[model samples]
Target: MGPLIPQEIISLDWNLVIAFVVGIGFGFVLEASGFSSSRKLAGIFYGYDTVVLKVFFTAAITAMLGLLYLSLFGWIDLNLVYVNPTYLWSAIIGGIIMGLGFIIGGFCPGTSVCAAAIGKIDAMVFIIGIIIGIFIFGEGFPIWKEFHEAGNLGSLKIQDIIGISGGLFTFLIIIFAMILFKTGEWAESQFTREEY
Candidate 1:
């Protein structure tokens, strides 16, 4: 809601309320999708289950298509949508750490919270680790401030970066997703786990 208040449709006051409602809805969806199970959420890395990939890929495609269609129909203004500025070094390092944490702990931050809400011990421990990490980062912010701010590339869209239209980019992504889906299916069959 920080940047969204400037947009046409939603106002400042309702932003927090909308965010709270959407967050709850998102958590419910995650729980319903079996993301509350650490094994299920971690299965993507082991190749036994591909539900995580399928769900996330579907979500990305749906959101992209929804926004594109909404813009076309004048239901939403794409120009008004906020894009976060890229801090390349920070992003690369953060992604690596996050990925490692996800693989080792069997829960990403959001999924950990979702699982913890439903009384998962592992997820609770993971959340505690996350809090510790956050505290460390906050306390050591000054020391790593330069590295965190390094490689500023401004806000970028994939379509803009690749010199293609947004629609064409989305189409290519959809095709890639189809291929990935098939690959995920293959992986699941090849790496079937009895526990999963």
Candidate 2:
């Protein structure tokens, strides 16, 4: 009834087709959201623009609510979903490194692809940097293997850890996002500029 791939009700070809369609939708949305511009993307960090944060948090909350309700109605099997295994310290370390990359390069792996598609030179460089980072990770995988496999907290949901009602948690996250959205809107006004 859920996770068409894991359950094997759908063929691999169907999966690929779905993936392609989803990728196109994703790309279209990113471009329409102005994510193709590195300056627009970078503004989230500098307080000049915060479309990035607003879109990110809004998407997160939307998905969070959808999953919560889907599970509640037994429309989806939450356990069948992919859960990123926690690697303890590596999450913090990797997140910090990614944050630095985003701040400096102004793109993550996905958005960088869109930016490069739209003829952004800096995004092209960022894509190259990501490739290099992946190459480095592959070469050094042996060294990081221990940390990568460490603290194996298997497939967990937020409710599993916090012992709260899923609906309550989703509501709280939405409230938090509303606060951030307000702040982001304020910063956009306060930090508006008349010159490039």
**Each candidate's lDDT (Cα)?**
0.91, 0.87
lDDT of 2 by residue, 82-111 (tens): 888777778889899999998898888889
Clashes of 1: 0
Cα RMSD (Å) between model 1 and the true structure?
2.2
Off by over 4 Å in 2: none
TM-score versus the correct structure, for each prediction: 0.95, 0.92
Which residue pairs in model 2 clash with each other? Answer: none
lDDT (tens digit, per residue) of candidate 1 on 19-57: 899999999999998999989988899899999999999
